[model samples]
Target chain A: MSTPSTSSAPAEAGPRDKHALAAAIARDVPDGAYVNLGIGQPTLVAEHLREGSGVVLHTENGMLNFGPVATGDDVDLDLTNAGKIPVTELPGAAYFHHADSFAMMRGGHLDVCVLGAFQVSANGDLANWHTGAPDAIPAVGGAMDLAIGAEQVWVMMTLFAKDGTAKIVPTCTYPLTGLACVDRVYTDLGTFELAASRGRADGAVVVRDLSGISLEELGGRLDVPVVLG
Target chain B: MSAASILASYADAVADVEDGATVLVGGFGMAGMPVELIDALIEQGAKDLVIVSNNAGNGDTGLAALLAAKRVRKVVCSFPRQSDSWVFDGLYRAGQIELEVVPQGNLAERMRAAGAGIGAFFCPTGVGTPLTEGKETRVIDGRTYALEYPIKGDVALIKAHRADTMGNLVYRKTARNFGPVMATAARTVIAQVSEVVPLGGLDPEVVVTPSIYVDRVVCPTAQES
Candidate 1:
């Protein structure tokens, strides 16, 4: 099994930081898309979307066109995202009852939803809610709804776990949140497009990568083979 | 107009709740939770209670206080394990408290379905996950959906910004989460509002919940207590 390089430093700054990866994902979100940014790294996508981009942000708590994180007096304890962090409401923001807001989610009205993941199988199965650890407290928020409800499901996460385990595996060992739902996986290493193929549940191809990392190096870090396209 | 539904005190407002009753406590995290009502329930000391909400609570406040007080036997919610939900974490790990995690959308729809008198609905959410295990499934127009049942409560504890003497309610921004739907799904709806105005003080267009659903109203002290 190939291991992540242990070099202390690289000559150039690679796409290893969260903000850079977030920006990379933000660039692909089309204008006029009604998007739901899931908790954790997916929430960072809101800060990266172009200011004038017509991407309307939806929070399951019942707000549309919700703004960036709030600071100082702007913080309204009641105005928050799924992560329960205070957020400002943008101009033309509308609030509705929680059930109505979720109708927009589960009714397949959302265009795109970006979520974080613990494991993503080659066939696009997603597992992020629980690790099934005996002591772990599992909470399945709106992730299950967004994973299967949106027109497109995009996942934002690191390529590997802290223990050097590949998150994009041939099959998920963790409990699944949805099956055959993830369309693309964006990681600090690069972006991979998952496609349905014969004889394979799903085939992943690296569409973009950092300058410092080659396709061969990226492929070596995962248990499953990823092609460079 | 009919007699005011206003209750004299918090204790009187929640006096009807009994042990093992399923209650829908409205809120999204700590935002719109009926803190005063929860405190009353804690004081009432009803045991084996089933709580339905978006979250357990942020910290040692709201539903967390009730759980910390050992008044809750089970929690049916979408997000129960928040960062500050140590009280629930302790009880859950010790096998003292039971949890039924639902997707946020599904949770809301189930409550709404109950209020609307819908028997059951097929939803695309949780189609192939463990949430669908042992549940009925159907294929409509070549798309698979899991059958979900309506969720009704014995009582609903709701928080609103204001209510008319007649019990029509208006919510404040995102704090309105779950209040309107829970109001209709419960046998008795008890609303804790910050202000109560005369009938007609609220515009019909702005009223989120009509008076027909509310059974009682109370204005607790300004503090969360």
Candidate 2:
């Protein structure tokens, strides 16, 4: 059927705060690298980044040299980002043809891209946009670009939704933006890496470590099965 | 469905837009933007317009063309990077271009809400800060949130990878950046597509933005700009 369908109720996953997970993923982004910050919690990655890392931030709006958040007198009302807020511009940054900017993305020049995810399958299918809900907003923005354009796609999201369902599923029933595109997943419970395999047989998503939280307690907050390895 | 008019020529596409109008161009830094439409807008001398985009391009290209023409009166985006040129810094110092800056995430949510017909919503992003000043505030769960207004546009300019005659768009990678959302949030949505396909040819599930929200289409020649 043309109509996309999913359960009205959110899947039950463990309780987790997204901000903490976002912070964890931010730690992974190295210094002096070209990065595209996706919308949603991923944008906060810039705020949490360490100073003097020489990280060059690229927004789809056309920017390269941006410093840490604006503070005190540095806040220029006119020098803002695609989001159109006052931001600090670093020295030696240049704006060029936006087509060249996309060329950078499609050309696979970005080092890392942090994106928000709705569902990440065990086999590494990334589906961030379009939940198939009729009531949900019907649009997918730069996510498609960030997913495939960046060399590494790191998804920052909570382990579960408000209804306690695991966003990290075995298979994504919704439309996918990229196949086997995810590199790692950072959730409140801990971090998980999709065990790579030869083909689409669906690899196992193994949680590397837990932060002093029990699996049973964490599983209580999710709708999907959480196997403790 | 009424037969959607195909953009047979670039001149026809440029004619629909006027000078000095509030124009919201889709894309983030530079991905997913319609370079051809931007060129046409520049060629048409549509100056002094309120330009809303994620960020201005590096220099003398993309949205910078409008900025160069001195056609842009104001820019409303989440963040404006300073490395592009000293002119923007001077403009801010001189207050020539008023920049209404919102947090990047909040800006996207506000745009999404505007497109979804939501009047307003509360979020803790800007509460208890200068960003909250002069805006509504509410306390929930012992925490305060700033009441953010929705974002809408008079004209939303977007670029898609492929578009069916029905206007259903399929964006390729980063090019999908704010294109779909900008398409719906604007009073009039204009798109520039690399390829125009038949209606049924595009899979329904793959279509990101439905044709119902689209009003005009501009096809760019393959010649590199």
Candidate 3:
């Protein structure tokens, strides 16, 4: 239970480390975008968002314009993000009821929502909530609402599971969170964009970034056909 | 119409809650939870409760205390699996507690629908997910939406930062989650406020929950040291 000081923090990372990957995603966020960063890896994107980017963070628990995670004596249990981590409120922050908070998502007011996923099919189907293991407790939280609610859904995760299995697959074996809901995915290896939800077909995955791997090598690794962006 | 009664103590606030009542406990985690009120309900010994909240419970306080005491027969919530939710996890794994996991948005909207008197609404949040299985499905404007029904409660236990004697409420930051919505969706709404002001103290523009929706207001923090 020790906090890693600045000196102990990992060396300046390659473009594929989790923080770098988060930065890559934050770089592409349109200015003034209303974004909901999902729990886990997507949460780090908050640190990467440009100052004055006008990116208003929406925590489904009910608050907007939430600032980065709080520390020291600034933590207020009453002021927390969707992740239930105490955070500080930014200027122009507003709080609302849960009903209105979800309404913002369901009504498609969010410009982007980044989520973590177990698997993403080439067709853009998202499977993040459950592993389908019988003993695993199913807790969906707001993943389903965010996946389908935001104008664009981005995923952040490793390209492969701990077992060295590819996470991006021809079809998801896990229980689906939403059908054809993913717009982009940022992984340790590179960034990939799903075909538009409308005209997308099998093997239409587009490669937006590649780190330390050749296009053909990356294509050979994942089940989905990869095209250069 | 008469204003909400300003009850003196937490125990008296939940005195009439019957067993087997579906109680909506407001909170995201521990933020907006009416801890004293729930503790009072426990002391009052209302068992077989169906708890509806954002989270099942955390650690060994508040809602967790209720679950640990085996009072909650079922939990209708969005998320139940958390690091500190051992109380719920143990009950669920033992097949002792029923778990109904709704998407967070739907959980809120369903209660909103109950308060608004809407019968059922179609939502596209979980269209192709397992959560929508066996539910009514309709294709509107070419997109499929699963039909979801309202989730009304017998009692709502919530916490607010301040309340006027008229029961108009204002919340503190994100602790406001579910308090306003739960206020309208329950037959009997009880709120615990840190401070209660005289009538007309809260500005109408900032009153999140009007007095009509809140039946009882308790100042439990006043009784605390």
Candidate 4:
């Protein structure tokens, strides 16, 4: 929402738009890697993948080697992503049932996965499934599996909540999805990496890139310890 | 011999469904949802059912309509809340229906364990999370895992792309989710396919589900085709 105007906006503004954030994360994806993009904002990474990158897309609903979004006659209700949107199949596309599909993840067959998170603790504990709010219907689709299964779990989200509260905190108040699972975070304002310690409260945050904020201001905003990568 | 009975009508297919049956309904959403069969089950008037699925319901149709009819007593699924799931949201808030949310992969693999005749398995999916609370936890090879049990169903209603007269089934793309596994996990498996081929019409190698797992087959769409 902090994206500046095309002509006068600073190259590195306060917060980049979702498209720019997606492009940055998509570029970070290694070549020839198998990746799963979570539903919602993370799904945009698929469209920005480099051409001929050989990046195979996996959907938890039972598909691999799937291509970008399908339009026109290419649309098939049966062929879709984890988000259940119409998608295309690559030449080496394969389809299995839900069991085999999740096996690809829980069996350590995936290279990376990008997920959205509500809160990420200093030690990389992720809490995205539920807010623990009253009258909330908690729905966790392959989050727990994907969190622990992927070789590297990258998060794509906003750095702060709408009320200006930092989501990257010393501890998370939401129900935990996975303990010490996140490796990196790509947000609207900045990017960060975590020296994650599983089951331990000692996590060191590293600021990899910054757009709109200074290191001092960012550190002041967050309660956790952070340093330059 | 295969126990697959070819039924002429979808309503007759689900007529024998008794009350309090734990049914596994297959689909990732609307892709492989057995809409006609569910409509038929609604007409069949079976009540107090436990529905197992990946999602509770999306819109006001298929499983949503089933929930709307006050037939389901509980839903055992991974994801029950979605933007279009107002019907389930209403029922859940009113405390009329009970819910058990499992992780998506665990939901699939649990049924797979049942189909494979495995007693129980240790999985790292929900380790140290609230989803695995009160369950047995083990340290295997230095990694933590929670003990998981199989989820067997009394009846499984699924949709497939094609099925042979012998009940060998194949599914289309992502729509194939939970169908093949549910077929084996259930005591009685019923399938609604778009096409019904002859016994030898389908190749054996590409068949996702063999005839041994299926109990019945119906093709209302084939008549339309």
Candidate 5:
């Protein structure tokens, strides 16, 4: 949905905070979808999803249909998400062996999976599990499985790293979690989709929504070029 | 029926584990950790152990205590680092311990394969990632997958809510994670349960882990301050 503009007006401000970005992403999730929220920022998507949305949340730890963060006497130390935060089991929730839970993951039973990314390439290559630091111990965890197994992979992360470097890169220097698996990028700055071009190996990133930054200003901030929707 | 699998003490349950033994510790964080068995292992002070678990540990107990005591040589796990996993982080940063980070799905499948008598399986989980490096890759039905090997353990330390004298176990809620599968993958399985009941007391339909897989069952005593 686009608003036709006769004159060049600055695009509206992008998402102001992480919560806004998470809400932006949550609005796009369809009803009755089986979704897995990765650890970290992606976990917040659960809190922002439209109430009674019929979205079934899957945790790699072996529970499904768990409710939001547990509080007071509702907290069960054993019942937790992949992030190890206490959660409540909703009515009709089911538990299974770890293998069966993973089977649900690796068998493509999930409709969508929201993940956190360190760097996402123009061609949708994902690098999240490791930073490629010499002294850093690379922990793959369940990220690799969720990235490749889900039907659509949505990455929720800040547009830039703490050092002011663009996380959306022309090519990733970090170790990859999956090759060309990311479907959309949800950031505090804006939301983007990967647009592949003919005869080009690396595709272009098209901004579908803006928060506070204009197209030209957003392009000026990055090393790579970005297209406006 | 044969003799009951009940053991008199936690120490006796874990007595056969030796130096450099590979152990599968079942839990998804602190939920199903065999706390009593871990305490016994800590008291026993076995060294150079290789552990396979979902996480390193929470706070300073269970696997963390063993690791803090410098008893573990390596850890093959899915998620080894957590906010409360300072013990593992310290040991890992110091280069005192080795780490093998496997994808959670791959880790679970490998353990299941060990118990199921399967040699290896092709899984697409880690393909196109650094985890796939040095591993065999094959294209099946136009999709690339990595060949993962089964992971067997010398002993498995598991937790359950209840166990029958015959060693059949029943787990509770999400605490059941990895316990039943680990039992099948190990040469010896020692389960710490809250209660032990007579063989016929437990319903046959509800047994999560069959009696054939468990070697010893121990009920943890009340903790002393």
Candidate 6:
């Protein structure tokens, strides 16, 4: 493995260093799991771990056991994540065939995959790729593999975009990545789960806001009924 | 003769196809291509079909419908977006589907090569990584390149804005995705269009895909939900 920061001590591992949502994700992730953390906000989960736990991180571009973001200038050019960002390779990490990496995804070998989304439907439908907007740059990469291949799908995103628009909606107008693929959704607001109802076997998904946002406040932006807790 | 050799409405034409056929969908992300026809294929219950697209849709719409129905057994795509957790994350966790991910550029080239009747081509994509497994690799210019075979399908589903009676097609804006290349890559090319015009109505220069490749055309259905 490549060593970029051997001099510095590992950052303090605890929940306070992370926000509430990050703490929730750390709580959900199990030990000795093969995990693929999606790019963007999902990558932040790497920064917070339960210290001394074994979580093998896999990057789609052929990397395993990558460390969190850079702490100092100790960078390794050869080792990086899927997004081409410099990442530290943890101990006991080894390089494998890229095909094997995909095989781990395609062959149902992944334990968990944390991702970001634009809109998550009440029925657990995901439509974060194409918004069907006129100028939207359309692309839906590995989202499918991580969506269907992983044993558990956990989403981490803000309740709304920077524009104050709700990222979670009743239905996704954009092109979908998978149907009812979401198992659990985590946001800055609260957590949500898909429940079964009469008509839909998978049932209606309910969003429980923990961020103190009133149900009526979230109801106005979303099309589904909010079961206030 | 294949049904591709005889057809009037692409909507009515694909009824002859049986289940379990492989489909190659063309486009880069949500760029130019036939989206309308994809809906029809789904409604047509083209079950057990192997689908090739850029990426699976995020949720209930687009390519995700097939995934939800469990109709697609294998998916061959290039770029699976990470930002959207809807499809890739969901399916990856359930372990219900098979994925063959190639580099975005290599994916497009392989599709192009298939349509152009090329057996195989070489590129540096997926060489050093795991993408090179069970495949041939060659060195060019002292750099390693993998031999990627052409990707063709039993049925080619495409979407376009306008078409002539002879099957010449035109795309509008980002919809022009993968139109030209995908048209020639399949044994049967089924197209869906918003409008169909007389053969001479379209300008010869603007036609992206010639009528020679298209076998049928269907008007957009309003009830496609």
User: What are the per-residue Cα lDDT tens digits for candidate 2 across B139-202?
Assistant: 7886556787888887888888777877788775445666777777887787888888766889
In candidate 2, residue B64 scores what lDDT? Answer: 68
Preferred candidate (lDDT higher): 3 or 6? 3
Question: What would the per-residue lDDT of candidate 6 be over residues B1-225, giving only the tens digit for each residue?
Answer: 322232334456567656888787754344433555566566777787778776665445557665776778778776554454366556755777677765544555577788788989765444433445778888878755668788888887776778776778876533444555667778888777777776598999888788778877666431221
Q: Candidate 3 overall Cα lDDT vs. reference?
A: 0.90
For model 3, the superposed segments whose C-alpha errors exceed 4 Å read A1-15, A196-202, B221-225
lDDT string, candidate 3, A1-229, tens digits? 3764332232233337888788888888999999999998899998888888899999998889988789999999999888889899888999999989989998999999999999999878999999999889889999999999999999999899999889999899999999998989888777887844336555467876677677888888887778878
DockQ: which candidate is best?
4
lDDT of 1 by residue, B127-168 (tens): 888888988999999989989999999999999999888888
Q: Is candidate 4 or candidate 6 better by lDDT?
A: 4
Question: What DockQ does each prediction reach against the true complex?
Answer: 0.80, 0.03, 0.85, 0.86, 0.75, 0.04
Worst 10 residues of 4 chain A by lDDT: A4-13
Give the fraction of native contacts in model 3.
Answer: 0.94
- RMSD in Å for model 5: 4.4
Q: iRMS for all predictions?
A: 0.9, 14.6, 0.6, 0.7, 1.1, 14.8
Least lDDT summed over 10 consecutive residues: which range in candidate 6 chain A? A7-16
- Fnat of each prediction? 0.86, 0.01, 0.94, 0.89, 0.80, 0.06
Could you give candidate 5's per-residue lDDT for residues B55-100 as a string of tens digits?
Answer: 8877999989989999999999988878899999999999999999
Candidate 3 lDDT, B96-201, residue by residue in tens: 9999999999999999999999999999989988899999999999999999999999999999999888888999999999999999999999999999887678
Summing lDDT over every window of 10 consecutive residues in candidate 1 chain B, give the lowest-scoring window. B216-225
